[model samples]
Target chain A: MIEVKKLRKSFDGRTVLHDIDATFYTGKTNLIIGQSGSGKTVLVKSLVGLLRPDKGEILFDGRNLLTMTSQEVKELRKEIGMLFQGSALFDSETVLGNVMFPLTMFTSMSRAEMLDRAMFCIERVNLKGAENKYPSEISGGMQKRVAIARAIALNPKYLFCDEPNSGLDPKTSIVIDELLSDITHEYGITTVINTHDMNSVLGIGENIIFINKGHREWVGDMSQIYTTSNEALNDFVFATRLFQDVRAYVAKHGKI
Target chain B: MILTNSLANFGRYCMFLTRTFSIPDRWSVFGKRTIQEVSKLGIDSIPLVIIISLFIGAVCTIQMQLNVSSPLIPSYSVGLATREIILLEFSNSILCLILAGKVGSNIASEIGTMRVTEQIDALEIMGVNSANYLTLPKIVAFVFFMPVLSVLCMGTAFIGGWCVAAFTDIIPVSRYVYGLQTMFTEWYVWYGLIKSLVFAFLIASISSYCGYYVKGGALQVGKASTDAVVSSSIFILLFDVILTKLLLQ
Candidate 1:
């Protein structure tokens, strides 16, 4: 489990996060949803030790990440895997090489063993035959899958995905979300995803935290999402065309 | 304002260099980045180096043959002249200019893209020292590869000069070889090698720094790449002059 305590972050005197606290539990997809510029990315980055919080502590299984030495932090990093917004695969390496990178860096596994592990991860992500292809040669959806394969190669204890479905089509986005959710439950890893995709929230958001203007506006599961009384969240959720049509239908039936 | 800022930046850069050197794990990272950067920098730059060195040598020989008219200065002395010029100025300065355009731009753009894409941040979060992991290998590669490339450049230029002299009948083959063997000093080769090492350090450090500090987005990375090549080229020429005066004295 990842626990964030009183996390405060500022940039050049402007506060981006205001004492936000949240817990990302294991074996579930915990979603941090907010509009652009609402500090969702900053909050996730701070939790992962990519950005230093101005005040607060991030405890990964009771060990404070910020207080750890550089060496200790690196050891802890072996347990964490991150999927970047743009799939951030090494352009120079083939898909197989990219997936094998973490294993090569952190483990003394033999070439055959490493290849087996990498191939297994690639097949797990459903990218079986694209091993030799470079990132530029693959489609955007395939690239995201490759990134996921690379992320899970080490079987990390914590998984963080930043806008994992950003550039994909809706169908592909759902597939990616399901893949991540399934992986989370299968591995029982602490999974935290930063996204504003309503489909993701409604589909696999076992636990969701909504941030508005750098403040945690709500924290609950998908069941409580549509019924939340918070006007800002209501405006956000009901602003969707599908939800708006449903609202209009309910209003016409005098059931709103 | 620029002067003060530049001075402060220089101070900060010096501190960064010192801190980088002081780290205990510097050698390990240097070894890794060296192998990576050498294949990317040295092996990739060979064709351009050969083409440029040969053509420049041929041109210099033809020009020298056409311009000089002293009987005391043998017509075949063009080979020796090409050797001296290539070893002293052309290989060290011109090759560095080419690398600033090629390798320097590549290093900056690659690292800058990594910065914007959060790969560097990922590395940092993973407990890896971004500087040691990214920059040190590049520095080691440049330092190790540049001197060897300089030697190759010199050899190619000398051969090109000899071929041109033979074709143009500017000098007899025996006289050209004699002039090359007798005229040039060992110091000149040493001087060029020294200059190549300095040029490599400047190019790699500045280019990597440009990439490392890139902010904003893809646009910022493009800007950093341009800045890296431009700055590295200018510094290479400036340092060439300073080192020439200091060492050739």
Candidate 2:
């Protein structure tokens, strides 16, 4: 499990994350939802050690991430995997090369073994036939899958994905969500996803935290989001007429 | 205000070069990447370097002839001047300035794009020292290639002078040959090469520093590319005088 304690971050005297605390358990998909510029990216970045918090401790298991020595931090990083928003695969490397990179960098595995491991991850992400293709040669959805394959190449204990569905079609988005959900369970990895896509929230958000104006507005799962009386949650999540109608119908019938 | 900003940039540049030497996780990774960068920044650069060196050599010879029309000094003196200027200054310093615009901007934009695109962050999150991984190989390749390119420039400059003099009725062939061999100190070649080595280090490191820390989007990346070339050119000129004073004086 990953635990954040009173995390606060500011940029040029403007607070972007305000005294936020949350815990993400292992073997579950935890989603952070907020409107653009709502500090969701900042919050996730802080959690991933890309941005240092102004005040707070991020405990991966029990060790404070902010206080760990550089060597210790590097060791801890080996247990973490991140899928970037743009599917940040190296432009120079093929899909198989991309997936094989972390293993080549961090391990003494033989060349044949690395290739096998990489091929396995690529197949797991359903990108088996695209092994030799460059990231640009494939579609955006394929690129995201390649990114996922690369992220899980090292068999990390924690996984983080930033906007995994952006620019993808609805069908591909669902495929990515289901893939993430399957991996979280299969690997028992603590997974954190930052997204504003309502479909993702309803589909794969086992634990959801909503942020508004740099503060946590509500925390719940898909089953609990419909019944939350929080003003911000209602305003944002049910802002659509269709969703509001569904909520009203559910409240009246208690069946959704 | 400008002074403060310049000082701050200088401090950051110094720190960046200093920090790149702290050992990497794997030396083979660095070595293989250095070979790759040599192909990118050095091998591919040869044609342009050759073209520029030849033309500059021709121009230097012509200009020297124009400046010294007096019959007393003899045409051989012009050849000597052309050889010295091409090797000691133009090939090393001016060629570096050109590369500062070409290679320097490329280093900045490529890395800046990687930065904005989150590729560098991806490396860092993998526990890789992105700085050493990205820039050190580039620096190593430039340092190794610059002196060789400078020598090539000098040789081509001499050939250009010979060809131009042969085609034109300007100077006798004997005097030009005499000029090439007369009072030629092998140490001058070493001096010019040393100058190029220093300038290469400046270009690679300064341009990389500009690129690696770039923020924002495409516009900011373009800005970083411009800043890299501009800063690298300025530093190359400054180091020219400083190294000349330190080494040649």
Residue B63: error of model 2 in Å? Answer: 2.0
Task: Give the lowest summed-lDDT range of ten residues in model 1 chain A.
Answer: A101-110
lDDT of 2 by residue, B1-249 (tens): 999998998898778777676787788888999999898998888888888888887788888889998978887988889888986788899989998988999899999999999999999899988888899999999899988788888888888888888888878767877888888888888888898999999899988999998999999999999999998998899999998898788
User: How would you encode candidate 1's per-residue C-alpha lDDT over B200-248 as one tens digit per residue?
Assistant: 9999898988888899998999999999999999899899889989998
What candidate 2 gets wrong by more than 4 Å, as runs, is A245-256
lDDT for each residue of candidate 2 in A195-222, tens digit (9 for 90 to 100): 9988899999999999999998888999
Best lDDT goes to which candidate?
Answer: 2
Candidate 2 lDDT at B222 equals 100
lDDT of each: 0.87, 0.91
Clash pairs (backbone) in predicted model 1: B33-B137
Model 2's interface RMSD: 0.7
CAPRI verdict (incorrect, acceptable, medium, high) for model 2: high
Candidate 2, lDDT over the whole model: 0.91
